[model samples]
Target chain A: MSPIATAALAKTAPPAPPRRRARSGPPTRRLMAPATLFLLAWMIVPLAMTLYYSVRHYNLMMPELRNFVGATNYKLLLTDPTFWHSLVNTLVLVMACLAITVALGLGLALLFNRTFPGRGVARTLAISPFFVMPVVTGLIWKNMLFHPVYGLLAWLARELGLAPFDWLAQQPMLSIVIMIAWEWTPFALLILLTGLQSLPEDQIEAARLDGAGRWQEFRHIVVPHLGQVLYVVVMLESIFFLTSFAEIYATTSGGPGTATTNLPYYIYQNAFFQYDIGLSSAAAVGAVVLANVFSFFLIRFVAGNLNAGSAR
Target chain B: MAIVELKNVVKNYGGRKAQGPNAVDDFNLTTRDGEFVVLVGPSGCGKTTTMRMIAGLEDLSAGSIRIGGRDVSDVAPRDRDIAMVFQSYALYPHMTVFGNMAFALRLKKLPQAEIEKRVREAARMLDIEHLLERKPRALSGGQRQRVALGRAIVRQPQVFLMDEPLSNLDAKLRVETRAQIIKLHRSLGVTTFYVTHDQVEAMTMGQRIVVMLDGNVQQIATPHELYAQPVNTFVAGFIGTPSMNFLPATVGDDARSLQGEGYRFRAGDARAAGLAGKAGATVLVGVRPEHLKWCGSGDAQAANHLAGKVDVVEPLGSTTMVQVDVGGQRITAQLDSAIAVEMGQPIALTCAADVLHLFDAQTGQALGLPAQA
Candidate 1:
C-alpha cells in the first residue's frame, strides 16, 4: 500500500513486447495463386459469357443470325406462363422436400440415437439411400415402387383390397417430392445425429432434476443446443435442392402438364430441345439470382439461430 | 426438510443377474432431518454413484431409498423432489442466469411473480444478480458455479444432491465457495448430500462425513472424530495431510511394549490393556507426523525413542518436516522449525505412548479402542 513499494514494483515491471508480423504471408499466397486463378477463370469467365449470350438473340440452329437484343430474353422469360409454372413448381419442391426431410430426419435421428442390439448396422442401412445416385434413386422409385400395376406399392394396395393408384400420372409433383425426400433425408439424419451425440449427458440429467418432462427437455435444451447445427443443415440442403435435376429427369421427365417441371428442366428444354441458347442462358442467370435471393433471406432469418448460444 | 435413508443400496454397471461386481455394494446411510452429509472418496469409489442413486438418477439393483419415510425407489428423479448440482456446473448454455434459476419453478407452473421473486432472492444470495441476463458461456467459472448454486437454491426442494460441484473451481474459489455452501446450508437447513474426492472439503463442510473406498463405506463420523479416532488405517492415513506413518513392529513378550526396527516403546495403559493377550503379535505402529519430536541423539538403545538418518528436510513457515530413513524404511516427522537439521545426519525422535496407533499388520484394522471412544 506504500508509494515507495508501488514505485519499486513499477520500476521492476518488464516492458510489453511488440507485435510481430506473420512470416509466411507472401510465399503462401504465391503458392496458392495457381488454384485461385484457375477457379476465377473457370467460374467467372463462364458466368460472364452466359450474361453476354443472355442479352443477344442467338439461336443454335441459326448460327449466322446473331443480333443484340437487350432485355428481350428476360422479358420473355418473365412473361412466359410455362416459365412461371416451372418456377412455382421449383419453389414447392424445395419447400416440401425440406419439410419432409427435416421432420423425418429428426424423428429417425432421435430414435436411432439410443443404443440397441444392431445400431451400427441400422445406422449404416438408414443412410444408404444418400449414397444411391440421384438417377438410380429415380429409377428405383419409378420401376419398383411406384408403378401402378406392377410396382411394390401397387401390389401392396391390390393385396389389401384397395384400388391401385398411379403416382407419376396422377400426382407427379408429389412423386418427385417423395423421391427427393427419400434420398436427402439420410443426409439430414447423419448431420443431425452427430449434433445430438455432442449434447452433454449431464445437461439432460440436470433437466430431469429440474423437473422438466421429455417435451420440455426437447424444447428448452436439446432443440436450442442443436440450433446452429440445424441452420447449417437447412442452408446446405437448400442449395442442393434448388439445383435438383437428375431425379425429375429420370422419373416424371417434367410431365403431367409441367406439374413437376422445375427451373433446371425448363432451361434444359429451352437449350437442348428448342435450341434457343439465348433463352436458356437468361433462365440460367435467373436461376442464379433466385438462388442468391433465397440464400440471402435464409441467412437473414435464421442467422439469429447461429448467435443463440454465443457468449457476449 | 426431510430425513433421507438408503437401505442396502446396490448398483452394478453390469446388467442385473450377471454376477459381476457392483459399482456400489450394500451401501446404507440414514441422515438426520436437514443434515448436511458429505460422501468423500477417491475416483471410481462410487461416491457419486451413491449420491445419484439417492437423487434417483441411478437405479438401485436390490434395495430402496426413502425420503421423508416414503420409499422413492420407483419414483422419477423429478418426482422425488431433489435438485442436483453437477461437477461441470451443467447450466443450460442457451439460458440466461435468470432462466436457469427460474427453470424448476416454471416447470411447476408457479405464479410468474413468485418465480421472479424466488429467482431474484436466490441470485442476490449468490451475488450473481447483475448476471441474470447473461448466458452461462458469458460467465467466468466462478460465476457459472454461483449460477449452478443459485439454480439449486431457488428450487427450495426437500433435498439437494451435489456431485463434486466444487471440483471444477480454482483453489481459492473452491475454498470460498466451500464456505459459501456451508453458510447456505446453515440458513436454508435443507437435507443435502454432497460428493467430493477432496478430504479437506469433506472435513470442512459436512456435518457427517462418509468415507468410502472401492464401493465400500470405510467410516462415517464427524470431522473431529474422523481426525482423532479414525476407524482404520485407511481413514487415519486419508484424513490427514502427509498422512499417518506406518512402521512395522512386533508386540513385546511382556505385552506392554512395542518394538520396531530401531526403537522400543512401552504402550500406554489403554493400549496395553487392548494388547493384553497379543504378545509377540505383528502390528503396525502408526504415528502422526506432528506427534513425533526430536530428542538429543545421545542413547541409541534408550526406551521410547527412534534413531534414523535424515533423508530430506522441508522447512515450512511454522513447522519443519523431516523425512528420515530408519532400518531401510522412510518416515516423516513434523518437527519445530527452530530445530536445524540436514540430510544424511542421524537424529533421534520420541513420542508419548498415547499418541501411538497400533493396527494389525495383515488386516490393516486398528488394534485398540478408538481414541475418542
Candidate 2:
C-alpha cells in the first residue's frame, strides 16, 4: 500500500538473509580417520613397497644392482616346473583338507547337538585341538606320531607285523594335509555346533508336526539354517590354511623335493634360502590377491544368506 | 474327525526329594469328535503338559492316549495325525507362507500342483492369500499366527491342538482373533483341544471347559454349568470373576439352618433334605457376589441376612462392587449401577437360600451334589 509502511514492514521482517548454518560436520571423516591412518601406515605402505620390489631386479645377494625388471619374476615363476608342481600340490592339499574337515565337523556338530550322558565333557574335548598352537600341533604329529621308526604310526605298523614306512618321504603332502585338517577341524566344529545349537527349536517341532522324517529335517531345515555360519567357518579356515607355513616348516620343511612347497613356503624359500627379495615380494603379492578373490566370493555368499534369512 | 481319549494319564517331573506333588497326576479326558474343549488353569497346573502328551510331543509316564479308537502311546508326533499351533506361532523363518503350509505335503512327496492347491485353499480360508509369497518375518504377528493356522489347516489332521495361541496378541487383537478361531472351529467341525490360563477365553471359546488346579481336574462342564454349579470349593472360588465368597458356618437343627457370626440362614426344603443330619459340623456357605442384595428392611421372606457397614464402593460403569465389613469378616457384593450407595453406610444384605452352595469344610467337597450329576 504505502511506501513508508512497506519500508517499515521490510525493516521489521529481517536484515540481509542469514547464512545457512552447516548441518553438523562431515560424518565420514569423523568416523573413518583412525582406520584410514592405520591402513595407510601398516597395510598400504608395505603393500606399495612389495608392489615396487616385485617389478624391480633387487636381490639381497646383489644389493648394489637394482633395475626395472617388468614382471620378469612372474615369468620365471610361471615357467619353472618346480613352482608349477608345488602349486598343484598346494591346491590338492587345500581342497582335500577342507573337504575332510567340513564333513567331520558337521558330523560332530550334529552328534553334540543331542542330549547325551557326557555331552558337556565330549564337547570340551572336541574343541581342545583348536586351542593348541600351530607349531606344537605340527611337532606332535611329526615327531611323536608320524616319525619313521619311533612315532606311533611306525610303532603300530611294527606291532601289526608290517614294515615301518617313511611317512614324510613317501607322502609328504598328504601327511601335511592330514595334520592341518586335524588341527583345524575343531575350529569348524565349534562354529557349526554353535549354529546348530542356536537353531530355533520351534521350527524343528513344526517340521516334525509336518511329518518330516529325521533325514528330511536335516536336509531341509538344519542345513539351510547353517548356511551362513558354515560360510564364515570356511572363509576363516581358508585364510589360515593359505598362510600355513609353521606346520610345513616344522614337519616337512617343503621337503623331499618341491613336493610340499605351497605359496607361503615358496615365498619363504625365495627370501631366506635363495636370498631373492624380488621373487619373494612377487609371490607374496600374488598370495594376497588370491586370498582376496577367495574372500570376495565367501563374503558375497554370506551376505546373500543373511539377506535371505532377514527377509523371512 | 477323531475323538481323543487320555485314560488315567500321569506325568511326573521326578520330584527332588521323592515327596513333591506330581506335575500331572491321574489326568483323564475324553474329547468327542467335532467338539471344542478347553483346558484352563493357572501356571504350573500341567495343562500344557497334558496337551503335549496328547500330541505325542511328551511321553506319558502312565496310562494311554487313543486317537480315533487306536492307541497312540508309542507313536511318534509325526504319526499321530495331530497338528498343533504353538503360542509363539512357530512358523519356519526360512520358508515362505506357502512353503510353511505345504511342507508336510512336500515331505510326503506330493505333486507340486497338489501341494499348491492345498496351500492356496488353506490360505484362502485364513484370508491370508496375499501373504503366501512372503516369509514370516515380513508379516505382522497376527498375520504370522494366521499363517501358522493355515499350516495346521492344510494338514487336515484328525485333531487340532493349540497351546495359548492367542496369548501373544494384544488384548483387542486377541479378542478379535479369538472370535475368528471359534468361528473357524465351528465351520471345520474337527475335534479341537485348546489350552489357556485365561478363564475368560476358556469360558467363551470352549464347548466344555476343564478347570484344573495343582495338576488335578477340579471340574469339567459347560460354561453355564461351571458358573451355576461348581463341583467343589476350589472350582467355586476359581470359575467366577471376584469368585464365590466362602464364609464358615455351622449346620444345626437337622441341617435346616446355618449359623455364622452375626448371621443365621434357614435352608429351604430342597436343600434341607439334601443336607439333613449334619448338625455341629463345619461347612462353607458359598454365595456369589452378584447374588447378594441389600435387604433394605426386615422381612420374613429373606432366608439369609447379615448386618454390615460398607467400607468401599467401586463403580464399574455397568455395575458397582461394594465391599462391606460384617462381623470381623469382609464380603463383597455386586449391585446395579443405578444404586447410589455411599461408603461408610450401614446396610443389611440377604442371600436366597437356594443359591447358597454348601461344601464340607474338611473334605472341600460339595455336600449334596452327586458325582456326574
Q: Which candidate leads in DockQ?
A: 1
lDDT per residue, candidate 1, A1-312, as tens digits?
899999999899996564444464457888999999999999999999999999999999999979999999999999999999999998999989999999999999999999999999999999999999999999999999999977999999999999999999999999999999999999999999999999999999999999999998888888888888788889999999999999999998899778889999999999999999999999999999999998899888777655653321
Clashing pairs in 1: none
Poorly placed runs, candidate 1 (over 4 Å) = A1-28, A303-312, B298-303, B370-373
DockQ of 1: 0.48
Q: Candidate 2: lDDT of B103?
A: 84
DockQ of each: 0.48, 0.40
Alpha carbon lDDT of each predicted model: 0.90, 0.86
Residue A1 in model 2: shift from native, Å? Answer: 57
Worst 10 residues of 2 chain A by lDDT: A17-26
- In candidate 1, what are the lDDT values of residues B258-285, reduced to their tens digit? 8878877777766666677888888888
Task: Please provide, for model 2 over B1-373, each residue's C-alpha lDDT reduced to its tens digit, 9 standing for 90 to 100.
Answer: 8988989998887733434777788888888888999999999999999999998888887889999999999999999998999999888877788878888887788898998899998889889999988988999989998998999998889999999999999999999999999999999999999999998999999999989889898888999888877888988888878888888888886667888996677776545655777888878888899988877765535669877789999999999999988888888899888888899898788988778888888878877664465
